[model samples]
Target: MNRKIVEAANIAINNLLPTKSRSLYDIAYNRFKKWCAEKNVQLYSENVFLSYFSENAKNYKSSI
Candidate 1:
């Protein structure tokens, strides 16, 4: 991935997560990337990241 994308992903992950859990953050980040890839969306911006959360938050809650 491009450095900017990686950096953006890191920032997004940090903002979304409550605590500093590296493993959990990694899992979420990877899953976010996979979802973006499958949807042909870029996962390198705040808007896209927020959109993913907005779209999937309910599902995430139900699954937990």
Candidate 2:
């Protein structure tokens, strides 16, 4: 079940991202999932995914 969910998340992330952003998106998505697991938080919903992506995008943009 967890593998399915993670795979779905990976597909969704890949499909929604632009080509130029793929690498960064992959890194951010992995980090977001890891953070969720470590913090005991659920990250399967659309809102949760968007929130995580947004937060990571902010950080990534600032670093550039």
Candidate 3:
């Protein structure tokens, strides 16, 4: 699940941004990865994702 979540994350991110701007994706993704590790939740789990998003959506929104 962990590996699949990481692969899915990379694929989803790459699909959203051009290769030249991948550093932006990397920085954003790393923040998510950090968040998941800190929370000890499966990155791809729907329940955990919703919980995290509910709490942290504002943080991401403010950055963008």
TM-score for each candidate, following the candidate numbering: 0.52, 0.42, 0.52
> In terms of TM-score, which candidate is stronger, 2 or 3?
3
Candidate 2 structure quality by residue, lDDT tens digits, 6-61: 99999996689789998998897788789778767764788777777787677676
Q: Please give the lDDT score at residue 36 for candidate 1.
A: 92
The 10-residue segment of model 1 with minimum total lDDT is: 55-64
Worst 10 residues of 2 by lDDT: 55-64
> Relative to the true structure, how large is the alpha-carbon lDDT of every model?
0.83, 0.79, 0.80
* TM-score, cand. 2 vs. native: 0.42
- Runs in model 1 deviating more than 4 A are 1-20, 62-64
lDDT of 3 by residue, 13-45 (tens): 668878888898789779778888888866578
Total colliding residue pairs, candidate 2: 0
- Model 2 scores a C-alpha lDDT of 0.79
Better of 1 and 3 by lDDT: 1
Candidate with better lDDT, 2 vs 3: 3
lDDT at 10 for candidate 1?
95
Candidate 1 at 58: error in angstroms?
Answer: 1.9
Model 2 residue runs over 4 Å out of place are 1-15, 43-64
